[model samples]
Target: MCGIAVIISGVRINLSSLLPDFLSPCPELQQVDYFSIDELKAALRRRGPDSFGTKKLILHSENEGRVLLSRFHHDEVDTSAQSSSSLTPDYETSLSNQVNRFGVPNSIGELLFFGATLQLRGLNPISQPLVDSFGNLLVFNGEIFGGIHVDCDSNDTEVLMGSLEKCCSCTSLEACHCGGEGNMSVPELLSAIKGPWAVIYWQNNSRTLWFGRDAFGRRSLLVHWPNAFDSRFLLSSVAPTSLMDKNSDLDIRDGMNNLNFWEELSCGIYSITMNAPKADGYLAGEVKRLDWANSTLKELVKWERTLIVPKPEMQVFKEYSLHSNGMLPELGPQQFSASMPAQMVLSALRESMKRRTIVSKRCQQPVPVAVLFSGGLDSMILAALLNESLYPSYEIDLINVSFDNQFAPDRISAKAGVKELSRIAPLRRWNLVEIDASLSELTSEIKRVTSLINPAETYMDLNIGMALWLAAAGDGWLCRECNNDDDDCERIKFKSAARILLVGSGADEQCAGYGRHRTKYREGSWLKLNEEMKLDMHRIWKRNLGRDDRCISDNGKEARFPFLDEDVIRTLLGFPLWEIAELNQPSGTGDKKILREVARLLGLYEAAVQPKRAIQFGSRIARESNRKNFGSNRAANQASAGSVVIHKPST
Candidate 1:
């Protein structure tokens, strides 16, 4: 896991103000003064705590209708160059940390890169932004579960970079003019990978920059298009706003149209030619959207997520009309129904869990794995699967957070769920960490949490973000900290040292696990239900993943979703609508029926029958937030809980 950022500017702008989102005063992360360049680095450092580095590239316009690119490494001072910051802390060119480096933008454009490493993979830590011998640069924030082969002893970042370098068939950076050819083209290489990622790769030979989130947008990447604010284009793993020049698109002062600060970059492969004619001091080359090797996925704005969801073709539906005598008939309500993909789903989800949990450890703890555990169906399944994957010597942390203190739905279920896991994996130690928060604690974090989950306002977004932030932080007292049955034993408050948190995000989205799915089924039959599920899957990237990523990573721990793995999605997509769920049945039993069978296959009975629960409600954060923010739960409930945006703070 890592935090990666790229900045391309025509004019030398104060590098300091680039990420005022990290400034830390505005309610949550919104309204704020510009931060120093060093402070910006500090913010990203939270995501990648192991190591941090940045690189600078100066592009000089040439007389021969071309651009010249040169790497800059300035250790000496430029006596003649004065600082660009003279007004109002110069929220533009002021970088007190790097005196004269960004002082002069003596080139056509300046491309700056920053990367922080979490060091989860490989035998040793590999510092990034990783630059190779030929000058190709990469700052990657993700893991390579599988696609191209990766050796256990090697770091996935190193392996992925090597694979990408092999795909670079260009001869020289000076006269390169062509797209990647053959099977190993850039798009093909990334599409084949079965993991979540957000990448920024600089191809020195082609003088092109390739960057975007994986197909599902499983990782967070924000884009600030060059607007009136500044003649700048950049990408960052986690940033609230792209604090632009004074005339930029967003009005940060009033914070009315705050979503404009930074938008989640669409999920796909995007390439920008750096050598093209300069358009407003940045690359004039049109950003190209390369198609996936799978051939089913298209631009996401149209809303067909074929990469992970079922293909919506007539022929595919026709194929499902005829049922097979697959072993799945016994699990469904019908004695004989469409061939269930239960076994395939079980296999795929199992492997996905294996890929995500079976990784190296960090923070020097015997227990390196933690689950944002609500002890609900999705989380319980993950815990059981995790127990199957890790060694018996390793302990697992179940971080359950509740604003209601002792009796939130999630807190109660978590206690029950932990007992089940203990019975199943008797040799393994499970630390059920109970993190109880009050209205005051939530008040203290309003600004930071709000900022982190920007572009996703509404009381509901806040409640969910706050719950996730607290749970991922994993700080609280262990249920058995005293190791005694006595209730009066002094409980020790300790934070889970685990750096990796496994979350069950995609499960509900994939399986018809929401109440809406049932209603849709009743209203328009199978067609409505299918469409509803597709919509949820299609928009999960924009609606949930990015906000969730920002909140979770804020804790210096990476959140891995086994349910969102590429293969897991493909396997579920293979099953017809009938096989995925039986929404006609009551809440818990029919919703996500295929996954229920998977739970049963893993010997989980009670969890298999558990119902879907949203984190905000499960943790009871929404109830508390409604009482505090809206003065009554009725008002928030009357208007959709997600309907109200936070009041814009005074500038």
Candidate 2:
């Protein structure tokens, strides 16, 4: 929710001279006129306007002093609730009080207490405390979800102090805060948590730093360690592209200095360091090292194998209800009903639209948001919802990017459908941009960008290219049609514009739109499929869509999936899969049957009646742009390697 930056040096250095320059573009910096430690502490506040906090450490040196600054934002809380008086508390009883109040889990008490910090915005702990029997300091980012607990007895700050005390007792005197116990180690703690996280801990007495991230790699953390100049280390959510000194070209023998590190795309929890090169400069020495002293592949695999089982059936849907602790309500069985699948589809679609439009009311002007429209069911449905909702008042725009590939199936008809929908929603403005980029041209680009090792890589490159095109055309939020039942591999690579990208992800799964659902129902295994299959399906859907969030967010854009809404999900849960399938089946030459029925009821039958074409197929994004482009039937294409065979145009 907030930006964080840190600089740690081996030798004492004055950070004040550079503080002003760094703080200029960063609005979070407070006033720090004096060299006093207290002034530095006062100046280092959290960046998020909605919440703020500061922590400072002064390291004594032979000359000047080295300083550390930490800041955080409490994004989940309301601005009005963040009062300084609420944070200031008596130190003695704070830890116990916070533990009781927050219901910190017993197993995670030591770790949570060390990094615990009060979130001013939400009046909750922004970071968990890292505590031991003695004292330790912990700093963590990302959520733990259903993992360990720390005593929330006091405010966040106090709990951290308490945890630090406990950890300091067990480890070596210098790094005692890391603790001597097995469960308290970084690897052990990571194994116990179920969600993404990046954590750093320091033992005040031991003078050591420990860093770790979640196994799934959902969050990004970067580090820079220069051996030649000061042996300083820096870590942040942003990448390390700009960490090196512009003027210095000195080389270090260890290969650890003046280097930037990032993990591979698929590796989990891979930690590498930037180090110095060997004296020979022949690339013989260790340039970087993985921090595996506390990690073991065997243990990680074992822990990962125990995946969480999903819930059974669609839970009843709750409306506008918050959890007892004020957290967002988790989707459960009680939130859905057992109804006809077609009705469920309609209900889920409406709910998804509602959630996607929920935005903070702080903007002076209506925010500009865009949806990537094609003449397809998903995109059309999303557009229809936006046309009626508060989204239109926010100056919502629709951009449909397509290519004029002759080989593509039903291209003309699809374009006609989009035109028809545009007329139906005449009050809204629509931009239909068409391109004729050749397959040969795209293939070269895909090879350049993806380094194409797999079919999945090729598809990802195409999506990225499409996103870049949309980004170039406008600055508003851009969304594409993404359904939960779609391939996971595809979801992992989907990206688009907008601070929040909206996708109709969960609708298909909840409403039984996938071909697999039809096969299962026809096979007469309804009882087995009905038990908790919906819950299991949702879990997979969330995980896949989550990858979309990570990939897009890596570029500073947030993704919002309206179909993931609890209301929509609950409605879909009540229906039978067969009924939903029938509604979606094309009626004669008409589009998705069930969606059209519901859209008609909502007075959007014209917009909804368009045929349901998958974006890749509809837009010809997946096919080559040449006459030689052939369908998946490779055997039939043996005699026509270079000749294109276009699909017959639909009526």
Candidate 3:
């Protein structure tokens, strides 16, 4: 929902040198130039455009150390709202009050803290770079679902910070014990909540910085520590453009060569002490040094599990799932029951859809959210659920996008499904906006899509980007028929009508929808099938999800995956291999068996029987993009951009 950037150092820095034009090429933003931090804020304004704020905090240190925080909002309701007051108070203004409590002298060199928050939720935006009563500061990106213990009225970030403060306070106490452990580590805090998030939290008392992403890195965060030998670091939600200047071709090449300077921070928690030797330390007869302690940077946790196969008790197979991230609690043995699986899965789907829809407090209006519908089993089921549950109060728009090919399988299937859906659950408005893209327009559009997903240079990645970008480019159904008559009559566009996108992204991975899963089962049975499924589940962060976030969020819409819901995933994982896939049946009859049953439960008989298809192949995007240069190898196209190492969460 927002982009965040940070700079931490042991010495004074020229802010201009730290920030360069590292953004992916965006045609709309090319005319705008940015040089300073303010300009960088302007460059990322589209991510959150409603309001803006910035804060600067000086750290208690011997040298000139600093932190900066800034943000913008995307709320269409009140773009004019701007106030001089920062969400995080200027540390300089609050230093005097803090000096008395800590008994630290003014002569100590100050460390600076800076942060930014982008507001996307209209009407009531969550204030960011929030400072707690204990002086700890937090700047967070992403939402915490309402299932958590926080008040529905308060901002999730505010509630998160409150929970953290309580945990930290309890840990610092001599007589207190939380979680049955003497002192709670930072990773342990994660076990309390579930949702997509990337956070930067600074502990004022300990002068330690704790930062990380969700179990699945749904939001992107890249870190630049120019030299491992130096004590300066920079972090941002978006990748910086390779070029400093647009006109200089040589500078562009140099920028590409220097791509090794920044790296995407791995998903999971990490802790580092921000304390550096100050003039006071030297005055106290301590030697000042440039090198930081090796212990300063430590990997506190990784988003993965260590499974322990236990001795069989009675006739059941028992396993203990242990998490490296202390935040997740220990899992008990998996229990199998004949009748519970269906009901459990259905309950999770219903709740996940609810949390992802109008039931969420995040929705400020009754206006309908859009779906990236392909009319396949995954999307059709989602549409049916939304139509039957929340249609009258909220208009439903099934936006189906395709390349210029009328005979494509996806196009035919989508038309059939839409017509059927219209007959089944007629709403106040069943808007279906279908788009057809031409080969002439494909080149420019591909460039734009690639620009949005920088470092995702691959044959498969390009296919995904092109498909999602085109789908998200549409306006609403109202302008579908009127575009030809009026050149000036603008389409409503995806960003304007829907702030949230309900996508059936994780269903394929969770339910064995791929051909590879079927192949694994045919050759090696359930053992191989389970192994392959687990790997896919783990690698989801590296594959489509990360690139999908960049492409989809670029349009100011957040994509929520109901299949990836915590409870839904757990239920699926607990199922026996037979429930997931009927290995003995012919291939077509077996794949995604559990999902088909769920669809049948919902009375979506047609959807329950639909066959599996990849979005790129189903949409004919890959075919269209490669039409002109037939039989061309994708490996050659890999050179379109340099490769970025995808970090896998390890136990």
Candidate 4:
């Protein structure tokens, strides 16, 4: 849950101006020579407030590389470099008053890694920008789940790094030469994990830098080339257009093409070599994707895949095929029972929840956890499972973030659902924390999040980004300080008790919850429905996960998706058409029928059958944003404004 930055340039440009000076207002152009690493660190302080530092390395005589790391302020800083006796901020006490402490970049070798860790166990020797014994430097952002067999004590990133090394048969960084043989390739290692991450792996021996997102693309890595027509590159978790820069490719003043020079790294593996380009000024090489269905790690030639650096205007690719690729391990080739889809789903979800909650290595006491609860079936089922779990020590918070609007259906639904569940699951501590913000307040948050999400090409995308931004801002909460007895008392405010938020993101895609799925079923387009399902799953990486990651991680809170777990997907994929959608049935009943049944089994009768509603609609944020953007004439302007069309399939 931190921000990571990497800037590589063949020439010695102004380090401060090398990136957009967006963290805050900057001095006049010629006033400063080098950009303050602290300022760059400050721009991303929200990502990692507990600890922030930067590092630098000279990869080539003329080429310069820098890495920045910022840890969440709620977590204790690693004091190995400082005195052991010195007292640091207490994580518990600092939760409400998290502060930013900026310092000079901790000069390391030829690489600088910056990001923060939410896990208590991460404050140890293997902190981050961790260089393996082989000299393979890793600046990883996200968690790696430990399924049934892994040791509980090892850090997810450390274990993943070790596993990658073992699979590749690369004893040292020098062994990973372009043509050198290794047991596995980068894709093979990536295929084996079931977590969300964005990583930058620098191969010291090859002097090559490899970067990519998890199959889900749950984290972001934005790279900007000052001269789109050159090899100088700057990558950051935050949007690079926060402030105007003299060397920027964007025209920040006019705000027309600020993103033209910036692009998000797509959801696939890519490698960049240090060799000089031949014809085009752009780096030469083909970006290779692992042929999940055919390739193995043994064929280790130097990665020659040219990087696919997409333009800011182009829609991102949506082929994050986990099953076809090795993102999830191959399951037994047995058909699942048509009538028992609910049973199978329950089993899968139970296992996923168990695996996701494994205590970190250094965690000795219970910490507050949360669920991005919408009171819908997907979220309700997830909450029900957590309530039923044995982890009673944790205070489970139901975070329902919404905006002030015509009718707050999301808030109303959440309140009703939470009330109902509390009676059924009386043993669990399910505190409902409602975070509501004004449309005006959220407009700025939306603008801020846009840098990370890039501008939404469509109005629908903008609504989703705004809703997500409000949820991530951690700005509003229920006012607990007010007197309940007083009718006029301040009943709602802004506060959060949890550092981890669990979401049911993948359920809808796997179970055909979209309105289009119903239409496909009515038209007898089972194949099309299946394809759409796959497409949604694949597109989640870029469309939903990446933007969601930026918004939520901004608060230093990590998001976990049980529905997106490997085992859960496997079970869902095994289901026959009947479990996904019934051909002749009504839209709501047929769509996500299996998940509804599971919800019933968990005693969430109301939520079990609740029809699908996009977050923007359910939260009423979309309606409000339109009201704010278009004023009283929103309806009349719909056609020209590109308002989202809602389809209501016949029941």
Q: List lDDT for all candidates, in order.
A: 0.70, 0.37, 0.55, 0.56
By lDDT, the better pick of 3 and 4 is 4
Off by over 4 Å in 1: 11-36, 64-67, 74-107, 169-183, 240-256, 276-283, 296-340, 361-363, 481-490, 649-651
Displacement of residue 498 (Cα, Å) in model 3 is: 1.0
The list of candidate 2 runs beyond 4 A from truth reads 1-351, 359-367, 391-394, 405-424, 433-436, 442-499, 515-547, 550-556, 583-596, 606-611, 625-651
- Ranking the candidates on TM-score from highest down gives 1, 4, 3, 2
Judging by lDDT against the true structure, name the best candidate.
1
Candidate 1 on 485-585: residue-level lDDT in tens?
Answer: 34566667979888889999988878889888899889988888888988998889889999899889988888899988876776676566666788878
Q: Which 10-residue window of candidate 3 scores lowest in summed lDDT?
A: 282-291
| lDDT (Cα, 0-100) at 160 in candidate 1 | 86
* Tens-digit per-residue lDDT, 1-651, candidate 2: 322334342221112332333211111112221122222112222111233333333332111112222222121122322244343321111111112122321101011111222232123434333334333445555443324453222232333334334432223223435443532533344444543455555554444445555443444444443223233344443332222222133233244332223222222232221111122111011112123233343343222211112223332123212211222235465643333334556665665565445443333334334455554566566766766655444554444444444334434543554556556676554433333344555533433222111111224333434433432233322222432122331322222223434444544554444545545555645543343345445343223333343333333333345554434444443333333345224431222345555665555555455554544455555444323334453632454432222222123
lDDT by residue for model 4 (126-233), tens: 555566676665666767664213466666667667765544423223345434454555655665556667777766555556767765566777766444233345
TM-score of each: 0.83, 0.44, 0.72, 0.73
The reply for model 4, stretches above 4 Å from the true place, is 11-40, 61-112, 120-126, 146-150, 163-185, 225-230, 241-256, 276-339, 361-367, 405-407, 455-457, 473-475, 479-494, 633-637, 640-651
lDDT of 1 at 31: 20
